[model samples]
Target: MLKIVVGGQINKKEIFDYIQNYYGTENVKLEIKNDLDAVMAMQSGQFDYYIGACNTGGGGALAMAIALLGVTKCKTISMPGKILPDEEIKKAVDDGIVAFGFTASHVEQVLPVLLDAIDHKN
Candidate 1:
């Protein structure tokens, strides 16, 4: 099973619920953590992927991840008025992005694509 950690300034519960519902408990294990602990877990190899949501997607959702995991391993797939294309998200998965961030409002739209890509990737 894939292990995913939820860490963001907002929508932690919603994102966790969405992933659990769509991916199912059988397919993935999830945990909600504060940004620092989450990033540390990720860096220490305790989790496979990270999902976070914020207003801008980048600033709050990914700042800790980017700072700890490095920018190359992290990505902001959506922002306030912008969401990356499905192919791009898939490409990010293929290119090895282990952490993803998006605006809280884009959770429904982004999770399907992101989780699908992650499912296929594993």
Candidate 2:
């Protein structure tokens, strides 16, 4: 199973909708809470991966990563490119889950590539 955690009140909805559209409503779990909540959940071994969406994608990622870094196998990915195609982001989810680590200005740029990497890894 793959677990995806979205941070921020407004941003979480946007990312959650995207995940459901691509992965199907039943395939993914949604977390609409502060980054701490998501991170703690992941650390508890309840989730396999996390995807936080703050305005800059840095704050949320940082909070989750810092919390989950030692507790669970975790990674942080960014989309400095603003946003990418939904299909592309979907494909990257698996890889993002597997890689469990990333940080950059443009998260959109690496989302697709990260997905490919995760897919290949599996």
- Using lDDT as the measure, which candidate wins? 1
List, residue by residue over 1-122, the lDDT tens digit for candidate 2: 45667654234565556556656677556555566776677667776656655545555455556555552344444445445444544554543432233333334465456444544544
Candidate 2 C-alpha error for residue 41, in Å = 0.6
What is the TM-score of each predicted model, taking all chains together?
A: 0.98, 0.59
Badly placed stretches (over 4 Å) of model 1 are: none
Q: How do the residues 20-55 of candidate 1 rate in per-residue lDDT, one tens digit apiece? A: 999878878899999999999999999999999999
**By how many angstroms RMSD does model 2 differ from the true structure?**
5.6
Q: Candidate 1, residue 68: CA error in Å?
A: 0.6
Output the TM-score of candidate 1: 0.98
Candidate 2 wrong stretches, greater than 4 Å: 8-10, 68-76, 79-112, 119-122
Q: Rate the local accuracy (lDDT) of all candidates.
A: 0.94, 0.52
Checking candidate 1 for backbone clashes, the offending pairs are: none
